[model samples]
Target chain A: MKRLIFCLAVLVLALAARPAPLFAQAGGPLRLEITEGVIEPMPIAVAPFLSGTANAGELAARISAVVVADLAGSGLFRAIPAEAQIAQVTSFDAPVRFADWKAINAQALVTGTVERTGADRVAVSFRLFDVFAGAPLGDGMRFEASEASWRRLAHKVADTVYQRLTGEPGYFDSRIAFVSETGPKNARRKRLALMDQDGANLRYLTGDMSIVLAPRFSPDGRQILYTSYESGLPRAYLLDLETLGQRPIDNQAGVATFAPRFSPDGLQVVYSLERGGNTDIHITSLVTGQTQRLTETPAIETAPDFSPDGRQIVFESDRSGTQQIYVMPAAGGPAQRISAGQGRYGTPVWSPRGDRIAFTKQQAGRFHIGVMRTDGTGERLLTASFLDEGPSWAPNGRLLIFTRVSQGEAGAPSLYTVDVTGRNLRAIATPDFASDPTWSPLLP
Target chain B: MPIRRSILTVAMLGLLAACGQNAPYGNTPPPGFGGGVPTDAVDVSVFGAGVTDTVLFPVDTWELTDAATATLTAQAAWFTRNPQATAVIEGHADERGTREYNIGLSARRANSVVEFLVLNGVAPSRLTTIPYGKDRPLEICSDEACYARNRRAVTVVAGSVDLGS
Candidate 1:
């Protein structure tokens, strides 16, 4: 009780210390309505959405919290606390009273209501309203789903608001599949992990039994392709997440495969094959398990990346006698060397825009983050560092997430992101070590 | 032209002899290259000036900058001066990229350097390349100042070269 009082006092003092109240007049739903078109972040309010007719078992609060959290976490909306909620909205179909919300300075409002459809099933509906504008931004959306899908409902609400306001797709509904790393640099322990975008509900897809690298999301969002060291041999495997099942993409030859990535259509898995001491890039059919050699001759052809339209692939090849990037048709043909003058370029990842390929280049002994158009032109190095590679795009294609390794007392890797403009560099928190990150498409 | 080439070759051989580990350094032997210099002593700290030259991209291209041709030209000259010193080009990426991609990129970087040297008259037999990516760093810190030092290709003489010793 004393602690509560002390915290309240501290908050009061701290808040008072500010030149003006950071949470003053415009911190409620009223501001949300008029502010929607203002281009600034619109303040909004989320009441614990009305619970379902079922038992709910604490999920009601959890679900409601998730919805608010998702919207707020995007650095977009300001979710006003329910503690100061002026009015209770019970029906998803009810007409909201804009005057009351606008008085609280909330320009927009998100109200959620759930109804039990079956024992484990429920119907969720959300209405986002612009208080000042006096109308819902989009048509009311309701979904018939399972209790576990409440999280998805949260994302949908955030997405709806995002689309309504920003005219861009929301990636809030996505998940990340990454190699969770532990141990030291020389002998590291790694596993495949899947987690919600906000780092919630983390689950290990692979046991820590063997080493794993580069877990990539399939187009369906229900599958992943990754390189595993099972059978004491490194190979690429396509895992059907729903079945908790696995299939080897290349088992007969049983060679070491590195840098496996999925085609944008999810029809193929392009990866590197190292057999009899020579490494090269290969493409395997997801359906037939049939494979085709993408590059031939001895030059360590590895790190294959595909353009978004699936017309061409940019990959690393030592064919010219050194490691540089070459662009080749997806149908398999002669490659034209694009990276002619760089020190060395590798890990060429084609952007979803189909215009640029992100790569790491080394020169004068330093590695840099660079990108170039599909024709191997307009190469611009974004960031310079000790080590930076693996540029995976943000769903909007505006940003990329890659790993940065800082060696000192701590010798390990961490995840980082940079605006494609090469500004606003920031780090994302990952438990333990993280690497080979492929961002999922915007969550439905 | 032939006399000049022969004289140049002989002078290079003499320079290797002066450096001590030259004969075994070049196409002479592989097993002899490793044992002498403590591989651990290979400094991961010194990457060249922050700018890397590539053949495809122009400058600062993590895409293997255009100057790569010229840098390799210079690196090839170094190899020419010390013929016996067979080199392993160690490629590294700065800390701004994904680790896996950087690793691959570094490998590509090192290979580009080796290729440039070979194309410019350095024997292909004299060069080996490996990409540490960002996994192994030359600089010890995470910031750009330190990162500039880490993104690099180190030409490690598989065998010790006599640095005029």
Candidate 2:
């Protein structure tokens, strides 16, 4: 992973310097309560950012477009089209025409400007305004970075705006590591690929020499753990994104290993290892390279995920004669079954917030992507299709991405995201057939 | 390539058996009968064509069926006539299950075949197992007909075998 480490020095300007009582107000700061019921998306206007320098015009427009797309893509906010705007932001420090925005039913507004600061560096600033309150929601801030990394600056601005309104961290700045597939279903060619959350900056991490499945990002977003058939058998390998170097997690030959995940602390990895005919979950210490068997069972046990706090682990197993979700101590112990539904369950992933577990369920010949409380209560299915599996949580735990394969001979797998409330279902655009999407933590 | 070689070998074996005993070497060759030919560097096709190389399994099952056992019995007899042969058993599954779980399931199926072969007089050291799960399907359709064929274990000849008496 080429770290896009931008020098985003926060240059707080004197404008909007007053710490307005946004959150301390009687009605609370502008918040979008994401519930299970239907929600009318909050209408907001993102004015085209003004260009401080002649060379910054195009970059300013591109940056503001990303901000608008990010906000609208969440399905919680609706971007008021630029054609409907009655007032324009002519300068960086221009006053907002609150009456004009209110007439367009724009409850919130965002205005920003971009300027060239150096030969290769640019500065971007933005302010979020509460159109209804006739005040700026928070202090206006500016970010400076290399001109090549303007997209990250735009995402950062979107993140700030999202945080101020929804009271949750933004996921737009994250990357996804997934298995990109092509060819036919019988002889599919799969390679590891990476991209921005919105499908920008697409790049392949590995060639199609061998089949790779389920690329998982490390907690720090610097490395990945995935299963590959490069050794002519399924085995887990740790890949350093920066160096593009990789090594098998276990050197023992003849045993198959797959379905790997990183511990929340990034010090260990839990994966499935098959010896002879039985499969069991095992944890390996990254620092010591020592492996310990976590689940000693003749039954199939795989797809292990660590809770955010690293105190517990959620996985799927067939010990009950049918696949179901289970929870056990992170150090290994007898697991308690958590699924009691009428279908088979597998690929259980713990939410980033540590409150729920997302999984894939098969019932009545239909597959569903679902979530439940950590203890297996409050079960809710988020998606249904011919085949839905491999649910990965966003960094904020507000959404999930999974693979959905259509039925039949020509069935192809694609990536889809849905809110935890079972709303905002949308497809992620990839260059080719894709699956096994794992979201990275917010970029540094 | 192996299939073509096996067909030629069978044809030559039939000619030799007919020349010697006035009978053709049938699909199930008699145990310990090498047909009076040097067995050095015998191709894997003989085992595949004459004794069968693959066995089908029920959905989500590793236990061998009665038909699978009969096939393995013939397989063991063929191995007895060729002691130097080593085999790799590939276990597979249908596309109805998750990827990782199917891997484990297919491993069990492959191990089941290996254990049966060992129990029926084949040397345990002569066998290795790999579980492909749903990754390698023989059929692409989603119906039961295709799935039944996909759920199988194949005993592929891996190393050189000396069939010479």
Q: Could you estimate the TM-score for every candidate?
A: 0.63, 0.88
In model 2 chain A, which range of ten residues has the least summed lDDT?
A: A6-15
Residue B119 of model 1 has an lDDT of: 73
lDDT of 1 by residue, A1-444 (tens): 999999999988876664421222343322222211222445788767776566653665676788877666555567888877787786556778778788788867888777777887877777777777677767778876786777877777777776665556667778877888876543356789887776777788887656677778887788888877564345678888878699877776535576788888898989887653356778988888898988777667777877888888888876675568888998779998888555878778887777788887877656677788877878888887766666777676656777676655365777777756575566777887887777888765
Cα misplacement distance, residue A425 of candidate 2 (Å): 1.0
Count of backbone clashes, every candidate in sequence: 68, 4
State the DockQ of every prediction: 0.07, 0.30
Among the numbered candidates, top lDDT falls to 2
What does the lDDT read for residue A61 in candidate 2? 92
Which residue pairs show collisions in model 2? A1-A241, A1-A242, B39-B163, B39-B164
